[model samples]
Target: MWVYFLLVIAILAWGAHLAWRWKQARDFAPQLLALRQQEGELPPSVSQKEFTDLYLRAEGPRAGTYVYACAAFMTVTLAPVSSLFNSVWTAIWQATGSDPVFEVGTFIHTFSFFLAVMGLTILILAIAMRRYYALMPPNLRQVIRHLKDAHS
Candidate 1:
């Protein structure tokens, strides 16, 4: 069926994405640690706790995005794997002429898909916030001010 075909493609894509994210996180660890160390050198006006809080506030959404991305990958792929198990179980049950047990697999598949959608929503919001910070208007305005001052 078309659904099964699409599910297979989705599973492959999710797997690849997860792998790439894992590597990216690994590569970022040292840089993150260095940033944290630099934060410790802040002046007395900024307490270590305040600096840490600000850092977390800035980085929290990005961390959440990665977490949600991983969760989405799992939820998207696991539902169909669960379905495959259910199908095998049904065939085995039929072969033995036994009464079929109550199946919750369909419910799980639906619930997993719902969670995957939520994960995607969170990921989108995080990405938007990340990009917003990347293009910080205030920082750009400061740069423009310095340039104008130099020219004047």
Candidate 2:
């Protein structure tokens, strides 16, 4: 029951995320094409100003909200495993002691949640990196820069 609930929520979150990504792509089609024409591959992150300008047109906040919700879906699967799974999760945890598998509908819930979490994390990191450039701490920035330079 609880596992099913988590699965449903995660599925919904993924759906929302997909829709938001589609919208972002549609909104940025012109810029996307321009980049492809000039640079070959798309840039990693659009500038914050570019995103902000696009966001201001409408649906920006909604897109951001969807990404955050996706993360919530991921969290729903982990941590305490959800109170809804008290009986099963507790029993399994007790039996296995930290090797608990999600009860019943867990596979779907776990996949959806984990995927959503990754997607949300990517969106946030992209946005932050786009605007702040080096906000992910100096060490991380240096590593990324080194890798990027190496790639180039």
Q: Estimate each model's TM-score.
A: 0.30, 0.25
The candidate that achieves the highest TM-score relative to the unseen native structure: 1
Backbone steric clashes in candidate 1, count: 0
**Residue 23 accuracy (lDDT) in model 1:** 59
Which candidate has the highest lDDT of all?
A: 1
User: Could you give candidate 1's per-residue lDDT for residues 94-132 as a string of tens digits?
Assistant: 676755343335565457545765765677667766776
| Residue-by-residue lDDT tens digits, candidate 2, 1-152 | 68867777776777677677767755665564355435634345544354334433333344455455545544554445444445554566567655435443467545755565576567755665465443322342343344345445
Prediction 1 TM-score vs. true: 0.30
Overall lDDT per candidate, in order of appearance: 0.52, 0.52
Ten-residue segment with the worst summed lDDT in candidate 1?
41-50
Off by over 4 Å in 1: 41-152
**lDDT, model 2, position 112:** 51
Q: How much is the lDDT of residue 111 in candidate 1?
A: 73
Error of 1 at 103 (Å): 17
Report the lDDT of model 2 for residue 41: 44
RMSD of each: 12.3, 13.5
